[model samples]
Target chain A: MTDRSDHSRATWRQSLQGWLWVAPALLFLVIFVYGPALTNIRFSLFSFSAMSLDWDFVGLNNYLRLWSDPKFTTALTNNAVYAVISVTCQVGIALVLAAVLEARIFPDFSANLFRTALFLPSILPVVVVGLVWQLLLTPTTGLIDQILWETGLASWSRAWLGEPDTAIFAVIFVSQWQWTGYIMALFMVAIRAVPRDLYEAMEIDGASGVQQFWHITVPGVRETILIVTIITILGSLKVFDIVWVMTAGGPNHSSEVLGTMMYRAAFRDDMIGYSSTIATVIFFIALTIGLVQIKLQKDR
Target chain B: MATARSFPALAVLNRVILWAVFLTLAVICVYPMIWLFLNAFKTTNDMFAATWGLPKIWHWENFSTAWNYGISRYLLNSLVVTTATVVVELSLATMAAYALVVLNFRAKAAIYTLILGGAILPPEVSLIPLFRVMAETGLYNTYFALILPNVAFGLPFTTFLIRAYMTGIPGELREAALMDGAGEARIFREVYLPLCRPILASAGLISAMRVWNEFIFALTFVESESVKTVTIGVMSFAVALRADWGVLMAGLALSILPILATFLVMQRQFVGGLTSGAVK
Candidate 1:
């Protein structure tokens, strides 16, 4: 009886020790991730300015203000546009690239070379990517314009990152260039995981390449597609580095998104409370997508 | 699987098309960096006049100018911050992951779910509150401001990665260690840590790259020239020398060199680490 009692006590002590081991990490999560996220909710509800300690509870005024603010609207619209375009182009191109590469159309060495070359851009620092493109797209003396004029396509060449009409698109294009390869690599992992036997069975049934892709490959990687889509959407919504570097959300805020807008409001415009509102919006959107991804994953 | 036995003509045409598309993509990915590299070695006049040509003169002065201006200082700051972050993050994450995987505890699921939340926690959402907290704590504009939050943010993903890898370690190896009168710490140190080296390398590489390349937090938290990281340094450098293309390019190139080298050397680990995250 004494031995049993001692054993139970020892087990309890071990359990406590286990928790103790994880305590440090949990402390960081609570302090940095969870604590601030919850605090942001309160900050969003208050009326406060940057660098000011005084605060008045404003209820939902900041949220209300977001509805009518033109800049906020543009930022939100731009984020949505970014999400849509990034999902379609990045994921779609990745799927195509992965499917082609997996089909082994190229010899082994060539395929490896192709992947390395494409993925090189994804690893480059976002700032460098921005600076290189900025130089390439400089209005008159840039290489892009020089090439266009030499090729007799001068009419097609305007300031790519200059005009409001083209600035956002140009930013989006650069993003696609940077990320498509990384996303392609992700899909390659998924595609490679599909059982080769399934494809062989379909091939034996006289299924064409297109038919095999739809029947076997698509279903095989459906879960990855959903996860990748959610990731892409969340990423696009929170995008900052690229936009900030490339255009500073600029040529008159044409390329402004939620992140840069929030930065400007908080830092430049001294609207801390309102910026928290934007951050809150981003958080909720990302959370919703994440939850949806979890649900879909669970169902699968 | 056997290669597709198709009509020769169709196969030939397919190969031709694939080669064209692949070559175009390769050029698109590679040409810009080469162009930048070439331009970095040219005089401003040469950069403008013969934009696509090889350098007439290999101007080593561009690098000297960039380094003297601010890149060297910023690089040192970045190195300090990134190294501290990686060290702190790896240690914390390893302990946490080990506890979660090797021990039987009641709140394991809840703790895991909470840590997973960090995977999606937008850093922007925490910016305002973190800024105020740092300022109040007198950590503002210090390396700790960057390092602490980076460590905090890094813990979740690293813990997740290490935990996953730990769980895959065979149970018998641990059981035998325990039967041999080994303490938990000894078993963990002797048995598991060595086994975890590959995944640790992967996680370490990923964390290093993130802390090294991070911009937003660095941009907001540290404003002084002395504390500014490479990302901010390069931004300010470009703005300060808006038309000095040679120096700007050199600064940009310098900022990328360490990360590029790390990536090339640890390509397998980096890709493996990234795919591990995806698997979650």
Candidate 2:
């Protein structure tokens, strides 16, 4: 009985020691992340601004205001459009590119060269990307317009960023240009792990190269596809820097996303409480995507 | 594999088509960067006059001009913030992961779950409250404002990666260390940490990259020129030098080149770290 009591005491000592190591990280996370996240939800219900410390509680009204806010709806719609286009281009085309690379159609040196070039943009700061693209898409003197003129397609060149109809699409295209290669690299890693024997067997059975890709490569990298898709979707929903730098959600808010809309309302408009409402909605959307990820992983 | 070669003409056509596609895509990927570099050397007139040619006079002064225009300050600020953030994040995460993985503990699962849950809390959602928190705490316009939140948000992923790595370490090493009368802390610092060097490097690199490139936090929390990171600095520089394309391009190049150079040098580690963390 005495020995048993001593062992229990020792275990308790060890547990306390473990807690000591974890405490610092936990403290920071709770204070800066989880704690502030909860406070943000509370902030959404109140009427406040940068000028005042007081938060006057006006429950549900901020949310009610969001329903009638045209900018909010436009932001939501733009984010949805961003997600769809991102998934289609970043995931779909990237997977195909990765599959081709993995198919051994080219020398290893050449393939790596292409991959390194493609991924160069992904490592750049989004600010740089946005700024660079903004310059490139400038009306008359930009490289893009210059190329169009050189190719006798000068009629197609317009103020891409200035047009309400084209601004969001232009921003989305730049995102794809920077990101698709990174996604392809991820897919390449997964595709390389797929058993080579499967391809050899398909070849023995007289399957075409395209047939082998569909039957073998696609299903083999299923989990990666799902993960990359979720990442792309969440990234699209939370995108701000590129849009803010390129358009500032301008051309009459045509390029407005939830992130930019929230920024403008809080900082520019000083509608802190109303902006928190938008932030809360962003949080829920992320939460929903995360839950869907969990569910899909479980289903697998 | 033999099927394609069975039809010699078809095989040649396929190869040619694939090569064409690859070369075209590569050009699209690389041309913009080449154009940026080319334009950085030209005068404003030269830039517009010859959009696709080499500069008539190499304007090396553009970089110096950009450096004087707050790019230097931004670079210094970004370096300080990124270093502080990565150091704190890695230290805290490594300790937490060691405890959760190696120590005999109660509530380990619960603690792990709570920490990992922070990963999905989008920064956008917490911006307003975080801004207010920074302001009230007097951390606003200081490095702490940026470092604190970056470390907080980075903890989840760093800890997750470290924990996954630590779990793979042999238990016998810890047992042997214990047999030698080493304390838990000693075992962590001596036995496990040396073994975890590869993963530690990976986590550090990934965190450094994220913190260096972070924008919204820098934009929101920092109000003064002294504290602004490169991402924010470049934004203001872009506005201030909008008409000076040569110097603006130089500034943009300066902002990106360091990270790009580092990436090129450590390509394998960067790719391995990114893919390994995601795939598992």
Candidate 3:
């Protein structure tokens, strides 16, 4: 009885030590992450500027304004479009490439070189990517347009980033170009981890290559697909840098996302309450999606 | 026998088509960066006229002009911020992960979840409050303003990553250390820290890359020219010189070169580190 009591005492002391180590990080998260998240709600209720503390409590007026505001609606709509298009294209291309690479479709191809080239853009600074794409898509002297004209496809060479209809799509294509490799890398590792014996067993049972892929490979990486889709969705929801630097959500705000819209509201337009409301909306959207992802993973 | 004979020809055609697709994708991915590089060496006229060709003369002056336009200062500021963020993030995460993974605590699961909660909470949600907090505390434009949020935001993922790795370390080793009368700090310092170098490097590299390339926070927090990081600096530079493609390309190249060089040298670690945490 004494020994068990002593062990319990020791465990309590060890727990105290453990919490001590976690205290500093917890403090930081409280101050920066959790605190700010909660405070965002408080800030959303008040009308104020950047630094001024004096403000009026406006209740749900800011959020109500969001419904009436055309820019906010456009930003929300554009974000939805960006999310749908980017997730489909990026995840779709990555799935194909990962499966192909895992299957070793071209045995002679340099996997290392291909991976390096593809991933290069993922790591490049968003500013650089925006600048480079801006140059390439410039109508008069841009390399893309120049090449299109030279190849007798001049009609296809109108300003890619200038027009409203094509601007968001253009941004989404740039996004796919930057991120597909990253998603592909994740999927490649997941597919490779699928057991080799399963494939061999299926082959012996007279399953064709396509049949084997559909039966074994697709289901094998389904969880990774889900996780990657969640990541891609969250990424598009918070995507500001690409849209900000590419077009500044311009050509009549055709490409504005929630992130950029939030920035413009608070900093550029002095709508702190409205900005915080937008921030709150973003938080709930992310939280709901994140919860769904977690629940799905748990169910699996 | 006839089926076997025809299969080889079909496989050969399959290989041909696959190679063509792969090569085309590779070219599409690589051609723009190469064009950017080639354009950096050309004058404005050459950049316009000889879009596909190599530069007649490498205009090294573009780099000098970019450097003089405060690119060097922006690079230094970014380096300092990135280093500080990495150090703080790794150290705090290491301690926290060690506690969560190695220590026997009842609320450890809840604590872990709380920390990981930061990962999903988009920075957009926190930006205004953080901005207000910084302004109130008089840290709005300081390096700490940027470093504080960077470290805080980076901590959850880094802690998650390090804890995942530390869990794989044999508990017997930690048990032995405890038996020898080693304290928690000592066990962490002497036993876990050394074993943790690889994972630390992984977390550190990934977080460092993120901090180095981050734009939104830097843009929102720091307003002074002296404190501006590379991404925002390069953006302003690009905006300022919209028509001067030579200087703009050179500035963009300069901004990217350091990270690209580091990535090349540590490509294996970067790839492994980035994809390591994403996997279940």
Candidate 4:
């Protein structure tokens, strides 16, 4: 009985030590992340401003306001468009590019060089990317316009970022430019993991290259494709720096997204509670995608 | 493969087409940055006059002009914030991860799942309330305003990666340490940490990159010029220098240079850290 009590004491000490080790991280996360997350949800059900401390309860009025708010609608629609385009370019095109690169048709040196060059922009500060593209897409004296004129396609040269019709697309195009290579790199890694023996077997059967790609590579990397798709979609939803820096959701809010709208509401317009409402929506969407991603990872 | 065996000429043509496509895409990917670098040296007149040619005179002063305009201060701010965030976040994460992976406890899985849940909540989701919290706590407009939230948000991913890494370490090392009468702290510091070096590097590099490039927090929390990071600093600088393309491009180049240089030097670790989660 005495020995058993001593062993239980030791076990208790070990558990205490374990908690001690995790205390600092838990403290910070609780205070900053989880705490604010819960507060954000509570803040959403009221009308408050950063200018005042009072939070008058409004009972989901902010969310209802979102439905009538044309800017919110525009931002939501623009984000959806961004999502679709990003998936198409970042995932679809990037997959094709990755497959071609991994086909081993080129010399290793050149392929490595290509991979590095393509992946370079993905690591850049988005602010820098946005600013650089803003300069490039400048109307009259910009390189893009200059190139169009020099190539005798001057008629196609207009204000790429100045018009409402083109502003969102221009911003999305720059995003693709920065991200496509990164996604391609991810796909390349996945493609490399596919067994080589399958390809050899298909070759002996006289299957065309496209057929082999469809039959072997696609099946092999399907999990990665799903993961990449979810990540790309999440990224699209979270996009802010590009839109904010490039146009600030401009040409009359044509390029507005949920992120910029949230910023405007809280900081610019001083509607803290309303911004919290938007934040809550972003939270739910991200949480749902994140849950799905976790589930997929588990299944894999 | 069959095409190469059955149709030699067609194979050659296919190879040529692929090469052309790859080269063009690669050029498209890299040329803009090259152009930006080249254009930074040109006068505004030269820049507008000939978009494709070399600068008549390499105006090195543009870089100095940008450096003095606020890029220097912003660089210092970013360096301090990134270093502090990485050091603190990694320390906390490594310790927590060690405990989670190595320690025996009843609530371990519950705690691990709770921490991992933070990864799903994007920083934007907590921006409003966090702003209020920062203001009320007097952290707004201070370096902690940036560093604290960053450390908090980064803990989840860093812990996840390090925990995963720590689990792969051989348990025999810990057993040997225990046999030698080493305390848990000593075993963690002397045994597991050294084994965790590669993963620490990977996690540290990734966190550094994220903190360095972070914008929304910088934009919202710190309004003073003294505390502004490069991302926000560059934005305001761009606005102030909108008409001066030469100096603007120079500032832009300077803003991207540090992270880009690090990425080039540690390409493997960067790529590994980024894709490691997905593969697992």
Candidate with the greatest lDDT versus the true structure: 2
Residues A1-300 of candidate 1: C-alpha lDDT, one tens digit per residue: 012122333366677987888899889889987898889989999988966678989999999999898888888888899989999877887888877888776787888778777777888778778888999999667888998989998998898887888898898888888888888878878888899989888888777677777888788888888888988998898899989999888889898999999999898988899999999998998898878877987886
Model 4 clashing residue pairs (backbone)? none
TM-score, structure 1 vs. true = 0.95
Q: Looking at model 1 chain B, report the run of 10 residues with the lowest lDDT sum.
A: B1-10
Candidate 2 residues A1-300, lDDT tens each? 012123333377778987999999999999988888888899899998898868799999999999898988899999999999999988899999888888877898998888888887888899999999999999999989988998999999999999999999999999999999889898999988889999999998988888888899889999998988988999988999999999999999989999999999999999999999999999998989988998998997
- Candidate 2 chain B weakest ten by summed lDDT: B271-280
Q: Report per-candidate DockQ.
A: 0.51, 0.57, 0.54, 0.56
- Regions of model 2 farther than 4 Å from truth: A1-12, B1-3
| Reproduced native contacts, each prediction | 0.53, 0.67, 0.62, 0.66
Docking class of 3: medium
Model 1 chain A: weakest 10-residue lDDT segment is: A1-10
- Put down candidate 1 lDDT per residue, B101-155, tens digits, no spaces: 7777656677878887788877998999999898889999999999999999888
Kindly report which residue stretches of model 3 are placed more than 4 angstroms away from their true locations once superposed.
A1-12, A51-53, B1-9
Docking class of 4: medium
**Model 1, stretches more than 4 Å misplaced?**
A1-12, B1-7, B265-269
Residue B166: error of model 3 in Å?
1.1
Pick by DockQ: which candidate is best? 2
Off by over 4 Å in 4: A1-13, A297-300, B1-4, B265-274
Across B42-160, the per-residue lDDT of candidate 4 in tens digits comes to 88999988878989999999999999999999999999999999999999999999888777654666788888888777888888888888888899999999999999999998998
Best by TM-score: 2
